[model samples]
Target: MNYDEALSYINDKSKFGSKLGLASIGKLLEKLGNPQDGLKIIHLAGTNGKGSTSAYLSNCIMEAGYSVGSFTSPFLERFNERISLNGRDIPDEDLAKFTVKIRTAANEMIEDGLEHPTTFEIVTALAFLYYNQEDPDYVVLEVGLGGRFDSTNIIRESLCSIITTIDYDHINELGDTLEKIAYQKAGIIKKDGLVISYPQKEEVVKVLKDVSKDMGAELIFSTEDIEVVEKTDYGSKFNYEFNGIQLNNIKTSMIGEYQIYNATLAVTALLVLKEKGLIQIKNEDIYNGIFNTKWKGRLEILKRDPIFLIDGAHNLQGIEKLSGVLKLFKYKKLILGLSILKDKDVDSMLDYLMPLADIVISTEVSIARKLSAEKLADKIKKYDKEIFVEKNIKEAVLKSIELADKDDMIVFGGSLYLIGEVRTIVNLL
Candidate 1:
């Protein structure tokens, strides 16, 4: 099998299961010798920031002279991005081989009258199988959806679990309230294990605190003693002090305020790993790890002349954060491009975004769930702003640039799918 065939096989399967639970995933892993049991895990879950947090943690551990495997969701560029090692995607040959192995095992299970694993389940199972063979020192597992029943949550144990900023998302499957969503994300906390959380709403934190107590797990919020010394368009500089670990002037190349919070959570988790004697390293490793951490699609600058950029703010909470970052920059005008899914809170997202944009270009991503460009433009028309519709993302990219001057900033956002295509068009991917 080749990479294309492997991806086709996975995409051919159902996106989700007929029922929601871990039975099928557990059975599939058992059939494959439960490779998930052979690695140490740092499980992560939240509405946003999972990708950034996972990137920070994995880079740090790898820089500390240890191998790390990472499994994140919703690839921004390629399918291989979902499973990576030491900040690199899994190789094409290995992905094809493992997908074949998983298919054979899944077919056997069907022959035995068991339900076939869903797309996420099969890919997640492939990650475990590959990681077990490579035998990385650690594995960073980012939850694909709500954590409680997410396919990645099938692991039996973890060294630590992180819950990044939680908000209203996937309400139908998780819940509508913050507390209810917090309960779902807190499900990744293991019994008598350690869990780290970014600062959250009062109610959300309460739910997390209670869940940790009930599970006999210890919880530490990463806000213990974080002080941001510098916040600029260039990057961030901060001082972190937690549990006798003093990190001064820790720097990250990532922009925006939220990335600072993610960097803190990642550093806290790494300190725990160090305190437990998991790896040998010094402050230099942590410093280099953070400074060199690479994450795309969130306030990433694609061109300096026009300052063209892209972000993955598909939900209301994410839009709010992106708006916060945009507030800091001084530009002649904001030429914005957006393409979002049909199920999102479109009106609320536009409410936060429309006012900042001088000209809005609505585009449709080449996905089944995308909100059509014409319909999206109609929604923007109510805002009484300059709106343009382009069903082709490549055209939208060219038009956004055409609408921009060297002094004006062009930002493409509203969906990860849009961001991925923009990156590919701009040749950054």
Candidate 2:
């Protein structure tokens, strides 16, 4: 099948919807010769910063002269962005080939009385296959959702397990409270594995400590060592002082103060990787990679003239970061296209962003779970009577640009789905 045909066939399995188990994935992988077993992996899971962490770590490893494979979700542009070798995303031909293989295996499973894999499962299998075929030195794997039962958990162990800040997201599946969510993310920690984490709530920290003790994992906390003194659009200036090492003047290309923690977490994980003899990387690689890395749809300034800021801050923790950055920018005519999954805290998102918006353009994303534009508009009207509803995201983009002035800023967010669609519409991808 061609790339588009393969993608269509694979996505159709989403109709069965999130089954939330590894049994099906395990069986399927076994049939495909267990591509996950032959490689070293740096498994990462969290409520946020997983993508940025993975990207930085992969780049660092690559700079050290190792072939690195990275897997991230909800691609900003083409479906191929979900898998990459070194810095380049998987080529269309490779994705097409892997999809065909996965489809063949899936059909065989169905014929043998097994259930078909879900969209995430198929895509994950393809990542493993692609990485294995490329013979990478390491694979930087980020969990698509909650870590415990996630298909990526199939790896028996990793060189190190990293968890960025945990918060309430996917409440229906991963629980609501911070402590509950922490436990789910902590699932990636294996017996005696090295654990690296960002600053988290006290209760969440306690839960992680308890889990690490139970699993005999060695835990490294960012707050215990790393410190940040400055932040700006250029990069963050920080100091890294470990028991045996002290490094200064570390700067990352990513914007926002929150990335300071994410950068530190990546450094901590790299230190652990070095100790394990996995890859001997230098401090220069860390500095260069972090300073150069950029995760799109997070406080991204798409157009400077009209000032279009697009972010994928869907959950409360993410939105909180967005709110912080928005406060730093000058006031302008804010045109927003916000839509989140059904389980998200829609009310909290509106409560946080409504006050900043001059003209709110609510719209649904490509996904079915997206809250309808009309419904969101109606809800926002209760908070502010002048909410605009545009069902089509592309049309919403045109409207936002048309109504916005040169000095004005158009902020698009509330979901990664919306940010991705906007990227496609604006030809930024």
Best by lDDT: 1
The candidate that achieves the highest TM-score relative to the unseen native structure: 1
lDDT values of the candidates? 0.89, 0.83
lDDT of 1 by residue, 136-183 (tens): 999999999999998899998999889999999988889999999999
**Tens digits of per-residue lDDT for model 2 on 372-418?**
88788878887664567788988889888888888888888988878
| Segments in model 1 whose C-alpha atoms lie over 4 Å from true places | 13-18
Error of 2 at 113 (Å): 2.0
